[model samples]
Target: MHRVLLWIKQDLRLDDHPALQAALDADRLLPVYVFDPELLQPGPLGCRRLGVHRARLLLESLAALDGELRQRGSALLVLQGSAERLIPSLAERLDMDEVLTLDEVAPEERAQLDAVRQRLGDIRLLLAPGNFLLRDDELPCPVDQLPTAFGPFRQLVEQRLPVFQPRPAPARLPALPDNAGAYFASLPSLSQLGLGEPLSVANSAFPFSGGEPAAQARLRDYLWLSQGVRQHQQTRNGMIGSEYSSKLSPWLASGCLSPRRVLAELRRHEAQYGRNDSTQALWQELLWRDFFRWTLLRHGGALFRAGGLKATARAPRQLDRRFQRWCQGRTGVPLVDANMRELAITGFMSNRGRQVVASYLVGELQQDWRHGAAWFEEHLLDYDPASNWGNWAYLAGIASDPRQRRLFNVLRQARQYDPDAAYVSLWLPELHGVPQHLRHTPFLLPHLQLDALGYPRLESIPENWRPYLPSAA
Candidate 1:
């Protein structure tokens, strides 16, 4: 009997899991999850590589995966250490026939795989696809031929591409070898992982916990139960409420859910209810997610570089208190401040809000773009390395797109998007009493009036802007 070790990474779910299925093909399967200390350690920016919101979500996912494995007569073995060393040592000690896991593309993640391979002594390493909607070989064109500009990429994908039908979960996994449960410790809690309990942000857009079961259930609730997908495109940009979007990104980011599974469900929805623009729009966003993933393949580690893929270097600005205020949501700009506050508290932000905040950070503040990207990496629940950094690169005008740098007019955006101050007030309650008319720019009022409203003054005000104020001196 060939005994193999299944080393799971971001691809966390069991259903539609090609890697997990391959492990079952062997005579014996030992599933293990190692909590790497390097990832949990604080980075130079003083934020853990994984923040509390995402850390808690990952723990939930592991628990759910383990529960499902137990029902199948197998269990996930949880260990804590450097995976590069621990995995090789485990494979050697157990005399495993092979190690099966998901393939990684990012430089840091790929490094771990390389280290394991060097230590495995010719052990077979079967790496499957990451959690992408379409695998590399399945692409309509060679990945290198895939366009960097989203328009061309989307055109090519929609014109000629196939989304693989997801495979069903196994009815029953083969039992582990005798005494496999004793091999490692149980899954760690939020506290055990050196993190505290999750911060309960009031009115968080994504209040759902993590795991495959939750991921599956959310798909049902959003589409079938509530018919939310029918209006997803319309309300997706709204910042105030949870009903606006599908909110499946957190699951998608962690690999608790597969993009193929989502695609299959969207197809079924169209078949049952007939086709519509809303359904098509949702499908397009998934393709955008695919576009970012492909960008990583095209550019490699350049995605992490300060200048992104553009060969030309950008001039730097002072990244001192101003940058820190932007991160902390203390920026004097009302819309920018509210969005930043939302992200800092909730680990989530709307698509529209993301664009506005990104524009404010890089275009208006003139700060280094990578710093904002890193802060999002530290805080966002649905943070995808490619999407987060890729979007930043695009916003900074250094990405593959031929477009020039774009800047959002924040005050105008606040009026158009939050005309009644509904979204703003929800996240920034201190400004709730600042009247609907003055909500967008509370500082425009006289100093006495601003103080009377109990709202804190913005960190800075533009000199020219004060001349037009209602009671400016």
Candidate 2:
């Protein structure tokens, strides 16, 4: 009888899980998740790979996954310590004939796979498709041959869109191996993981819980019940509410929901509602996600380096007080601070707000882009290394079409996106007393008046911001 160990990495759910499907033929199966200490330890960039918010979500997800498996006569085996050490040892102790897992895209994750494989010895280490919309063979061109710019890449991929058919979850997973009861350990709490419980932010745009069930509910609500996707193009930039965007990213990043499943549902929605600009916009976002995944595959470790894909490129590497202020949302720029505070408090930010804050960090604060990226890795509920790092590199002008440096005029963007400064006031109550017209440009107020609000003062204002500042200020 064949014994198989299904290694569950970020791909948490069994629905449409390629690796789980591949392991079904085994007479005995065990699904295991190893919580690596490296994720909680600070990296070279001075930030832990996992933070309190994502950690809470991750624990909830693991519990939900366990419950699902239990219904199918199986249970998730939760372990701790180094994956390279634990996975191999578990396989041997269980006498697993082979170990199967989904493929990974990021350099660090790929390195982990290599380490685990080296330790597996004679046992086979099988890899299935990763959490992406397109399979390697289904891409328009080879990873190396794909366009460096998103525009050209999107164009090429759109030429022949593949029909996505996501598989359903197995009704009954194979029974667990004998003597495996000890391995189905209990999940840890946030405090036990050396992190405090994150406060519940009432104004958080992403108020949803973690797990496959929540992910599926979100997908259904977005595409069917509420049909909010119909206006995604118009409201996606809004920072206040959940209806603005699909909000499917956290689930996607954690593999609680399959990308192919999302695409298939999107196609069904489009077919029922008749394709519109909103649907097209969401489709483009998926394409961008895939583009970043493919980019990471092509570039490997370079995406996380100081210079990114451009070896000769000059990029900031300084960690100054300004970077700290930016992270704390005390930069005295209303829009930037509001967005940053929202992220710090809620562990989520609007898509539009991310661009604004990232540009400010790289262009205005002039801090190391990796520091900002690392901070996001710690905070964002939807942190995907490929999209997160790839985007930071793009904004820093060192990856994905180096010619584009996304520098935003903070004052201008504030007026355009948060004209009433509601988003600003929501996160930065200090600015609530400031007049709506002068809210975004509080720095223009006299030092005495500004000090009264307890808001930090901008050390310097860009010349370009003069045009966007209100005349009354």
Candidate 3:
């Protein structure tokens, strides 16, 4: 009998899963997920890699995966420890012929895979392509030779769009060995992981649960039911409500949803409704996601460095009370504070809000961008290493295109995106009594009124903000 130990990583779903498909060939298959305790500990940036929000989603995803596996005559074995040591030891004890898993691009994850490989000595360790939209062979050029900038890369890929044919979930997974029950362990709760349960926010943008079922349901709702994606380009920058965007990132990041699967459904939607700017916008986003992953593969640990791909770039490196204030949503800048507070409470923030706040931290506050990135790593339910670090570096002016530092004018962005200040009022209850016109510029309010509202006073206003401030303020 060909006994195979299937190790699950980021790709939690069985649908369109490459590693799970390869493992199906085994006569006796034991699928497992190794929950690394290190993720609960603080990293170099002094933030735990896995925070409450992500930990809760991860546990839910694991439970969902186990349910799906059990239906196919197998079950997921979640073990708490280092993958390198646990995987090898388990494989040797089980006398598995081989250990199989999906490959990864991030440096730390790659290192873990190597360590596991070394420990597996005589046993074969097979690696399948990771959970990404495009395969290496399908890339327009070698990853090393890919374009340095997103635009050029998008243009190059658009010239020859590869066809995506995602695999269906297997109807039957092989049964586990008779002794597998001894190794099975229960899933850990958020408290067990040393994280308090996050309070539910009625205004959460991503209110959906994590798993393949939820991911597929969302795809159907956005494309067929509500047809909200038809207006994606117009409403993508919206900061309020779940209808504003697809809200698929959390599942996408957790690998509960396959990028290829998303693309396939998107293509079908376009065929029936006819292509439009909105559909094209989502296509572009998937490409951007692919671009960042390729960039991470090419640059390795450099992507996470102080200078990113551009080592000589003059990136800010400072942290103080300003950083702490920014994190707690008390930056005294209404727009920045609202977005930060939303993220802290709901574990979700709009794309426009992210850029505006990140710009405020780097450009206005002049703090170290990595700290902000690390903070996102901890709180964001949709945090992906490549996209999170890459975008932060780009906005901080340390990534490939240093010339494109996303030093946005926060006041201008506030006026344009939150013109009515509804987003601001929703997140900042203290600003509710302020007039709509002056809500975003509370610093201009009289000393007594500002103090009464309990809002922090802006120490200094930028010259660019003068034009955007309300006349009444």
RMSD of 3: 1.5
Q: Rank the candidates by lDDT, best first.
A: 2, 3, 1
The digit string of per-residue lDDT tens for model 1 on 1-473 reads 88899998887789899888887777778888888767777687656678888888888899999999989888888888889888888888777889999987677788888889888887877898887888877787888888768898888777866746799889888768664656867677888767778777658888887899999999999879999999887887788877888888999999988889898999998999977888998998898898898887678788877765663246243477778988877775778888888887878999999999987887677787778888899889999988988888877764223355446777767777887878777766777777677777887667888777666677566554443343423
TM-score (all chains, Cα) for each model: 0.93, 0.97, 0.97
Taking all chains together, the TM-score of candidate 1 against the true structure is: 0.93
Supply candidate 2's per-residue lDDT for 165. Answer: 84
- For candidate 2, the per-residue lDDT at 360 reads 88
lDDT of 2 by residue, 177-266 (tens): 998987665798888888989998889999999999999999999999999999998999899988899999999999999989988999
Query: Ten residues in a row with the worst lDDT in model 1?
Result: 464-473
Q: After superposition, how far is residue 4 of candidate 3 from its true place, in Å?
A: 0.7
TM-score between candidate 2 and the true structure: 0.97
Q: Per-residue lDDT for 284 in model 3? A: 92
Residue 6 displacement in candidate 2 (angstroms): 0.4
lDDT on C-alpha atoms for all candidate structures: 0.81, 0.89, 0.89
